[model samples]
Target: MSASTTLWTDRPLLGFDTETTGTNVAADRIVTVALVHSVGPGRENETVATWLIDPEMDIPEPAQRVHGISTEHARAHGMKAAEALDEVAEMIADALRQDIPLVAFNISFDLAILENELTRLGLPTLTQRLGHDIAPVLDGLVLDRGVDRYRKGKRTLTDVLAHYGLEQDGRLHTADVDVSATLDVLRALTAKFPTLGTSSLEDLHREQMGWHRRWAEGMNEWLTKKGKTPDVNTVWPL
Candidate 1:
């Protein structure tokens, strides 16, 4: 467990993401998991660990369109959602306790979803084990929105990859592939914005939290103007 004081390039970061039955993190059951741990820096990088769990819930076709995991495929080979959820939650907490940061595209959503699942199962949520609000989280999405406030196109993982001139090695929907692509996005963003590159991971986390709130507010207002519900701002621990 490295402390948050560790240098931006020195800290170990565990990047997490989950594929679920749907987009409502609070209500959804996780169907797939992916984590990529990077230790050390640049050319000396050590990237390891990847897991794909069978989320026992019937993965809906609409959800499958996002991540390509079908109910039939998941049911045929997916691990029990409860079991996978436990392992995922514990691994994330262990990483955080050890001082390793967690990076997710939209960390708030994933962390909140995982917290809900853990609580339902009588396990400790990441916030509980961490004894603090979820900080030290690096969100590529938030960083991108902050750095390029008016980027022209979609801000999705794939869209951002193309925007940065980076190529994703694996298919988009798979967890590990998305994680790796996300890491690439972060590296590229930091490279382009030297200010972000030099900031310690802790500072990056602080900055991202502010950015997330602002972006969420703006997005919500835009949704209201269009006569739709602003759904992304739900209470995190729900």
Candidate 2:
């Protein structure tokens, strides 16, 4: 679809997510990754790709409890981290080149971890592949907070899904399932805020960067008030 004639929802969206060994984007490894490409507003066309990766490190118990993939299982059944990461990066780069939004919940974590993994593996990062920083990303978490700023309580993927009156069939924390849920949540958000649906993907992406920056600044301020060090990054796609 032409950008001038199509709304964000009318165009294709590539949903992405990762089940990692831990929450440290700088050091953690990806245990699993998923990418779902949805076309048309009704989602009549979709292509889903997923990979289980041997992170080459022990999967801590707490992390395993969240995603339910043990180190033994991954080592036995997963692809090499370098190979899997290369494929994931290439897929994402292809999507961005096609002007498709990469939909993810709390995308900063995924992108950050992926970049770190690529760098560690001596592979070209997304920026290098795309010739610039990744853009035109649609973050479900950022959009939810931007449009519904006053809403209280948690804003995790599950929380946002419930807030939008949607449900996931499979358990969360799985890469594929989480990607599907994230796409659904984005659709729900668009339904609730029709204006968002009407904007161009690039516009929506730029808007999200602003939204995320504002949110991070506010969080840092709150943390400072509580006498805690503010560690949040105000940058987008970090």
Which structure among the candidates has the greatest lDDT?
Answer: 2
- Candidate 2 lDDT score at position 106: 92
lDDT of 2 at 39: 85
**Model 1 off-target regions past 4 Å?**
1-7, 40-54, 231-238
* Candidate 1 residue pairs in backbone clash: 1-98, 54-78, 54-79
Per-residue accuracy of model 2 over 1-238 as CA lDDT, tens digit each: 5668777776788999999999998889999999989886433566889999999999999999999999999999999999999999999999899888899999999999999999999999999999987988999999999999989999988888888888787899988889888889888888889899988787888899999999999999999999999989999866
If scored against the real structure, what TM-score would every candidate get?
0.86, 0.96
Off by over 4 Å in 2: 1-4, 41-44
Candidate 2 to truth, TM: 0.96
Q: Cα lDDT for residue 30, model 1?
A: 79
| Worst-scoring 10-residue span by lDDT in model 1 | 41-50
The C-alpha local distance difference test score for the whole of candidate 1 amounts to 0.75
Error of 1 at 93 (Å): 1.4
